[model samples]
Target: MDWNELAMELQKEVSGQVLTREPMARHTTWRVGGPADLLVIPDTIKDLSATFSFAADHALPVTVLGRGSNVLVRDGGIRGIVVKMFRGLTSMTIIGEDVVAEAGCYLPFLARAAAVHGLSGLEFAAGIPGTVGGAVVMNAGAHGDSMGDVLVQVEVMDSSGNLTRVPAGLLQLGYRTSRLMDTGETVVKVYLRLRRDEPVEIRKRMQANLARRRALQPLNMPNAGSVFKNPANASAGQLIDRCGAKGLTVGGAAVSEKHANFIVNKGRATATDIITLMEMVRRIVWDTFQVHLEPEIHIMGEG
Candidate 1:
């Protein structure tokens, strides 16, 4: 698709950096993936819209990425255009009991901001390593709370560059999933409804949640948080551990001993290694408990 020429054209159309054959590894937390055909990092909502329009005109597929925390890009990489929303589009505002955040704003940072503003609902997000858009799409949670609980609405951009404001209820948010997962629409902004609280108390709760996450998760290594979602009435981690899948290895990937649901990259792990290990763990848990564990992390790209 003459990606280099397309990259040049896209750069001229949008106020953003455009690159050809950019490595997907550089964008994801797991740091294991091949190169993308084209990568665009937009500077503003206008820039993002222009890029989307350009892609639509060219009939190129678009893949949107947030913090890349809960994704696994395959080793064969991604085709078409990959739009990364991080350094750009991260403006946030707090008004009364509500917070308005751009899609790229880090979830943890938003949680801290809410606490600073004496808000109570986001303390559970203090340790989640994703962006607001990603949190909403995946219904990301920690400490028994999720984005679905506080989200009011979101601004999403479709492939043809049309933007719409969708209420949280319309998203059908449930158990680490939402209708957005299949829509190919990109979340541009988020509106959250939080309650006023004592700042000191909010920070205290956030601190406790962060501490618990640090103690329970494999934060020391390069990992994509939890690999599998808990089945109905069952913990995916406990089931995997019960099946003796912890510490099991496939190439450079291994099930974390501290948390069975995590597959850590023990230096030089490939996407294939992580995926193989996940399958092995899934098979073992299914064999032992007869519960089918579903993936919480989004798997993308080719292969």
Candidate 2:
């Protein structure tokens, strides 16, 4: 379908905001991407369902982005529609000892809310960036803890528009990976089960984590969290650091001196620059230690 005709049809079906040819750089953390042909932010769950149906009816490709934290969109623009869950789709409530958060809610927001309510299990996620949907799909974690540990259940919409609530046990979460990540399904919401702890203690723990993050990570610059996953029985950052990659640079992308696994955008780095630097790290690590480093960050779009 043509852009105008498709826009009219979507507007008639759902009362949500839609923007044409939106620059994807503004949406991602990396701050280096082209544009999305169509960007749709559905106001509610029903609106999201309708948008999914619209895409299916027109046979248009759709990408569901959360807070756009982990993705590295390529230089070439994305074709078709980009569906984002933010704004009205975000809703949180207390369910027994657990909190049910909509996909759009940011992880830090939820962590603060949980701390305020004396919920202890989520303290580890206080420094984690991204939305609940992205966190669940990636099994996002920090300080040696992951969302997979606190997640009780999650609701997802498959490619055919089938929504299902799967228990935590069925999610098959591993180190930085999950079934959702492999399938590319849209995560609607999550029900997390946390323990009740003393509010003062929870706050203290969260504060400590935040301090450590600031001291160790290069938060002053723009970069994806960790560039590579740690190989079994070895630390990726330590390996890279020992291999003299700490001062490495390619165009505007540089390997962070503070933490070796992080590649910071020193200035106006292209996606190609980041890719080249990542390859250099891989080659150096493999040649030095006979260990292949796998990237943990998700790289998307056409290069």
Candidate 3:
């Protein structure tokens, strides 16, 4: 089906923010992608469900993005529809000792909310820049704590367009990956099991974690948080650094000096530049260490 016709039909049925030819640069952290054919920001679950039904009926390809923190959109943009869940879907509540977060809730915000309620298991996520859905899908972690450790259950939208709640044990979270992404399922909510802790202690731990991230990560730059997955037994950043790939520039994209695993957009970087830099680092690291690096950042669209 033609995009304009589909968009018009969607506009008629869906009550949500819709944009045509939306710029991907504005939707991702790297800020270097072209425009998508259509973008939908559903404010409510009903809207999201209706939009999904429409796309499924039309056999349209769909991509759901959360916060745009750990993804890179290519220069050619994405085809079909891009559905982003952000502030509109944000809803967080504490049930007993568990914190249930909607997909749109930011990880940091979730951590802060949990801390405010004296919940302690989420302290490690206070420094994560992605959303709850993204964190759950990727098993995002740092400072010895991971989502796999705290998540009790996840509510997900199956490929058949049904939302089902699954136990965390069924998620099969393994180092920077989850069954959700591997199986092409969309996570809509998460229930985190947490313990009661001193509010002051939770805040202090979050502060320390944030300080450590600030000291080591290139937060001030426009970049996907981590470009490559850590190797089975070693760090990708250290491997890239050993190959002297840090501070190397391709156009305006440079391997970050602060964290070699990150490729920062230094104003006006094309997606091609990022791709080139990534390839260079991979090649050099492979040559020196015989370890092929895998990308942690989800790369999309085209360039």
Using TM-score as the measure, which candidate wins?
Answer: 1
For residues 1-303, write the lDDT of model 1, one tens digit per residue. 788888888899888789899989899988888898999988899999898888779888889998889999999999998999987889999999989999999888999989998989999998888889989999988778889999999999987778999999999999899999999899999999999989999999999988888899999999999899988888888999899888999999999999999999998999999988888888887787788988988899998
Q: How high a TM-score does candidate 1 get?
A: 0.98
TM-score of each: 0.98, 0.96, 0.96
Q: Model 3 over residues 222-258: C-alpha lDDT tens digits?
A: 9888899998889999999999889999999999999
> How many residue pairs in model 1 have overlapping backbones?
0
lDDT of each model, Cα atoms only? 0.90, 0.87, 0.88
After the best TM-score superposition of candidate 3, give how far the Cα of residue 199 lies from its true spot, in angstroms. Answer: 0.7
Off by over 4 Å in 3: 1-5
